[model samples]
Target: MKVLFLQPPMGGWVTWGKHIAINVNHAQLAANLREWYPNIDVHVLDCRALEIDENTMIKILKDIDPNLVYMGDALQTTGVAAIHPRYKRAADLIKSNLPNTKICVGGFFYGANAQNILEETESFDFIIAGETEATMPELAKELSKGDPNISVVKGLTYRDNGSVKMTDYRPLIKNLDELPLPAYDLFPMDKYVGFNYVKKYVETYHSRGCPNGCLFCVGWSNYDKRGKNDWTKYRIRSGKRVVDELEILVKKYGAKFVCIMDEDFNVYRPRVEEFIDEMNKRNLNVPFFFMGRAPYHLRDKDLLKPLREIGFVCGLIGLEAVDEETLKKLHKNVQVDQVAEVVNLFRENNIMSVTTWMVGYPDDDESKIKNRFERIDAIDPDMMALQIMTPLPGIPMYDELKPFIQEWNLEKWDFQHAVINTKHLSREDLGRLAAWANREFYSKPGRIQRILYDKNYHPLCKLIARCYVETADKHAQAAMKNEVFV
Candidate 1:
């Protein structure tokens, strides 16, 4: 049996210029398939990182001629997550070019719309509806036999006699540690580059599933069938295992920085503490970043300083909004003051923090928009990512906003682009305001000086700060000229 995993090409996130993070999903799945089914030939084609053209992808498919092609959705919750809708076209092209090869897809987007994908695309023979590690191998083994019974395979959707049918739901993995380390050696690791924040940034998945039930998030929706809060059930690898992989990445792969791509890194303090202690003991110091909620940072205040000692110099902090009312509407459960406190903490500890702001709420008007940015300016985060609010499917707000969504084209769902206008703002106006907010936050000469000259910030962080301003200025200019997005 032969299988090829692909990370399809992406229309780059509009907020930043062309850059590709490592497709950790592809690497991890390839590792699992290789480790469990040793006799089966496995390969990966990372079109996103390599920027492989369609011609090259088709040629590689023809050359390898694998029996099955697999891809992942990167666990997106919104239309924005459905990157490069070209995947449908690519799959169609592959089927026409190679009639016998089958395609399978699984991830956040696919899992959410399994029946639709299976029904819509002739190229997609199967959709792995849950975590693919355990389920994929079982399905592959069944496929090896003639006329496999897919009904036995849990968390799958497939065509049955010209109709889409789904199998029983699969349970989320109880222990994430059971999964193998991603096969980074198989990837073009050298080609991977981080965002402006870190150049040679390697992504790590120490945990899976978020514990927080943010109403706008699709985290809970993915596992909705499994029962409520199933999706929010947090699972993580041992800290030793996490740092052990980091040591390998640093020593073998020349990783300058590591991105802990957990939904919530600090959900459990003990795991974080263990990882920190392991890093200290091994002296496996390399710049690292992770995403954390505001409250957790407050809870783990003491340990954060030592984390800095281990090269934990930066991370994304979710200051999703400036006002308490907006935070409540989003079900962020984070206080506006807590948001301010955490931003201050990161600053005090020399940790460059990236925060987010979403415009276009129901109550959003010119005055509200102005006040939001004013509060943000007062808070003064190291970086602020501004986006027009997009209510993705499965979120509570999706049903409410669906009728008002002006851009039904899924590809434009990228957060940077406004898909829906608020009751108070037009889509174009939302885009303009978002642009204005970016300019407002980063345009000051004093702010620019602090960003570049802050002795507390790492040199790479300084570079990121400068790059952010330039990008925002470019977007602001485009927005001012009435462009929906830069």
Candidate 2:
């Protein structure tokens, strides 16, 4: 049996000058399939990196001529709502050329509503309804046995005599350690790029799932789609296992930095301690970074020094908003003071902090927007990600904002641009406010010079810091031109 996996072209996520990333989930899927079915041939085609059009992709599919082709829709790609058009175009072309081949897709996007996805797109033969690690291997074995009636297979949605039907939900993988390290070999690792902070850093995961019920996030919803309503089911790999992967990335792949793409890294203190200790023992000199809740870092303050000693150079934190009322509405469980403290703490530890904030909430007016920017300026994170509040589907705000969504274009849904307006601000006005916030925050006297000349940052970081201002200027220019306001 032969199987193929594809990362579809990033519809609009990168066309607007955003970073292009390797689909780590697809790499994991390839690893899962290859581990389970050693005799079955497995291959991956990253259309996004290759910049191949639908016709070229169709040709690649024809040349490979696999029995099954799998595609995925991950949250990092701004959900399938943005990529569905590209997905359908590729699926249709594949079906037209290879009618006998089976097509399957899985990831946060289809896993949310598998039945509806299948009903809407006949190009797909099946959809994996949950995490594919457990489901894909089992489905492969069943298909090898020639079992046409795969309703017995859990975590699948498929067409049945012209009607859509879904199988039972698959349980979440409780033991993340059981899964093999991602098949980074299957991807064009050198082509991957990130923001100025972690540019070209290799990706790995120490944990999965987030406990926070932030209204604007879809991480928890992904677990909910699998029927695991408990958000606290945040799982982690053993610290030793994580260190082993880190060693592999550094020694084998020559990774200068590793980015743990977890939803939140500071969920469990003891696990972090173990990781720090293991990394120290291994003397893994590679600089790395991770993301987590802002308050969690302060609560685990003792771990900061050790984390820094273990070559932790940068951290990504989501402050969301600075006002108490907005934080409460979003259920961020973090305070404005906590946000300020976290920034100061990272700075004190000599670690670069990239803080994120959102604008265009329901009650937000021009005054509130300006106030938010004022708060961010006061806090003064090393880097800032000012985003417009988008009503991405599956989040609680989606239903409320659906009625008012001004632009139906999926490409506009990337967090960098706003697709909806606040009660007082138009979409164009929101864009202007966002652009102004970027300019004002970075325009602090000597801020750019300090970052560039600071001896604390990694040499690679300094290289990026020198050029980041130009990137920010480009974004600001686009906003001023109102190019992305629509």
Count of backbone collisions in candidate 2: 0
What residue runs in model 1 are displaced by over 4 Å at the alpha carbon?
75-80, 196-198, 218-226, 473-486
Instruction: Tell me the lDDT of candidate 1.
Output: 0.75
Alpha-carbon shift of residue 394 in model 1 (angstroms): 2.5
Which residue window of length 10 is worst by lDDT in model 2? 10-19
- lDDT by residue (80-113, candidate 1, tens digit) is 4445365677788789899898888776556666
Candidates' C-alpha lDDT: 0.75, 0.73
Error of 2 at 102 (Å): 2.3
Residue 345 C-alpha lDDT in model 1: 91
TM-score of predicted structure 2: 0.91
- C-alpha displacement of 199 in model 2, angstroms? 6.6
